[model samples]
Target: MELKRTNVPFLLSLALVVLLALLPVTKTWAVGIALLLGAAVSNTVPSAAPSGLGKMRKLALNTAVVLFGFGLNIGQVISVGGQGFWQTAVSLGVIISLGYFLLRFFRLDGDTMKLITFGTSICGGSAIAAVSSVMKARDEEIGVAMGVVFLLNTVALFAFPLLAGAVSLSPEQYGIWCALSIHDTSSVVGAAAFLGDTSLSTATIMKLTRTLWITPIVFVLSLRQGEKGKLSVPLFIVLFLLASAAASVLPFPVLFKSLASAGKVFMAAALYMVGFGLHRSVVKKAGAGGMLFGGILWSVSIVVGYVLASLS
Candidate 1:
């Protein structure tokens, strides 16, 4: 009976993901609606949700990211990645350095500080999740980190495009800005998608380059802590690159296009799971200082990123 109860929510959630995927919703709307739906379901029957739901969410997201590669041009990826490398490295260093001072100023826990910093500087929840494993962070700390990032990412999704328009940024400039500044690949791509295809492509490639920084960061932390956690490029990123390479050579235009479209839907589905996982308790536990630190750090990152994007 307990097993059956758990299965019901899982199946229902799956159906909802598929249903939403078929709708003609924009990326922003899909993410927003899916999050609301997940929150509603989780809040209504919180206990009935499966414990493995988070893992499933990650799997869905990774798969979607890999599929997204099918749409990219290998030459473009190489060009964008090359251009963004130094900018990404410098940005990461600055964000982490500022985060350290803020950590001391706020008197927050070290583990939470690292988690938030990684999320802010790298790839939002993905960075937090990766670092948490090596750092052996408590569930609560991870929750707080993710919750803070989530709130900020949601704000960026809406505000960034409007900001870009107000500044009269070209699509390419907006793309670089979004890739440099935004928290997650999902949010970055979503915000850039609002601008146009050029923005979308540029943001995706540049953000993926930024994400590559996670491997070295995680590896160094693991060595320092003597934690033998798995150290490698995230599998999804490798697969995404492979898919891009194959798309460049393989003559599967229709198939690649379909997969890319499916990837967006799956990404939206993952957003739903992300929302469902962030319970109110977690948000409350994020604390005022943690929230302030993340918000302030993110704001500074935005300004710095925009400057770099303009100069680049």
Candidate 2:
């Protein structure tokens, strides 16, 4: 009985993961549910919630990223990269620069700023996870960053598809717009899939191209950390690349797809754990500045992306 009592949080978290897997919702919904559940449980049953979930969060995040590689088609990513390299580069640069200026105006902590910026400039949750591990960010900071991204992602998932018609965007144009504007690959894919197969394929390739930037940016961030004697590249990043490469070469489509799906499940579960860290104090620390920064940056990204896509 005592053992079960001690394990309620873990068991509840596991049940949430299973529930997420059974639901036919978008990644955004799954994460939101898990986060809300964790927050509620923490407030009501604080004793059941553990003081630390860092190890599990990090492990789950890394494993999910590596497995996500299985869903990539290296040829598609390469072709998209070759063609849209400059576009992505310019967009990322613009967003990062904008983020730096926004930081001056906002009252967020440095780590939170970096997390939000990287997440916005690149691939939302995955970018936050990768950079957070490198910086050894606080659990509260990670939760806050992800929460901001989550809110925006939920808005995008619903809004983009609706706006596609308003903007008179063709499937190709909408796909490119979604790739550039949406923060997460899952959300981008979800939004594009609503348009049709052409949009889905284009968005996936373009989003994957953006994901490729994760390696270089993370490497640069690691070097800048100046941990003089401990300058080792993260193993998960390497494995993520290798997994993509193997997927490109291997003929086991069924297996790879299954792994990728499992990765999504794990990511949802990890996000639920991330929520456990979000108490009132953490949310307060995140401040209105963090939310504003995300909202403004995402708005700019949407407008710019729309213009670029229309031109293309």
Candidate 3:
């Protein structure tokens, strides 16, 4: 059989995984490099080149999150989450309220405004995808929102760690700030991991908690728009919690360690996929006004979250 052209991107991605695995750099660096490579190459290929990689990306990420849970005990997850629940809730409300007002001030159309608001206020593309359905957003609107959100997320992946160091934030503080400020779960975990393993765990749990807000946010949107929207939960979170519970009860030190290590590698690969999905045309279509709106909200979130975290 002749070689299929569609498999080229997949093969390239797999080769990247192998090369990065052999590098002496940290896993976070490997992932960052992979992301850069993916973004650089994304514009060169057909739009369809990366389409098949989405499922692989999702599976890799879910597996990574579940495996990462092996490093935690359920109690730690519960305790940290409970302590920060009020802070997270307040931050979410602040972000949404401010984002809505600012987008309107910028005079963005309703669909675009809602897309950017949900993307920034919640879990980036996932939030956009969920709320767009309820709002009956056009395809172009969804693309624009996702493009803007992903671009900001990329900025956060690099900028956040530098900000953390400049401000001398503790790992816990950095993690909480990442959860509150970053646009997506992958970027949140990536930025936190750059800080250290403790920050990674804290950020992941806090980010997952933030994701739970998706259901309620969608519900509110539907109520206001008089449109029906199905609530979709990321089941991997349930698995992550279950894995933490199992780790707490089981005597599998070697097994847990192995899984955690593998999970880090999987996460790096997932980040690589994320970077590959970035398309310049889509970002350009998002328009400068939408980007400015997202930037304003994101900047405020980082500043507000940092202050709250420092206080707590």
Q: Which candidate is the best by TM-score?
A: 3
Give candidate 3's whole-model lDDT.
Answer: 0.82
Best by lDDT: 1
Off by over 4 Å in 2: 1-7, 23-32, 102-119, 123-179, 182-234, 309-312
lDDT digits (tens) for residues 49-164 of candidate 3: 44457787878888989999998889989987886677778888898888767754777777787788888878898889888888889998888888889899999988987787
**Deviating ranges (above 4 Å) for candidate 3:** 1-3, 21-24, 47-50, 227-232
Clashing pairs in 2: none
Candidate 1 lDDT over 160-210, as tens digits, reads 977976875778888999999999887887778777668878888899899
lDDT (CA) per prediction: 0.83, 0.75, 0.82
User: Candidate 1: misplaced stretches above 4 Å?
Assistant: 1-17, 25-28, 226-231
TM-score of each: 0.89, 0.67, 0.93
At residue 147, candidate 3 shows an lDDT of: 85
Q: Report the lDDT tens digits of candidate 2 across residue range 49-77.
A: 55456677668767876787787776765
Error of 2 at 258 (Å): 2.4
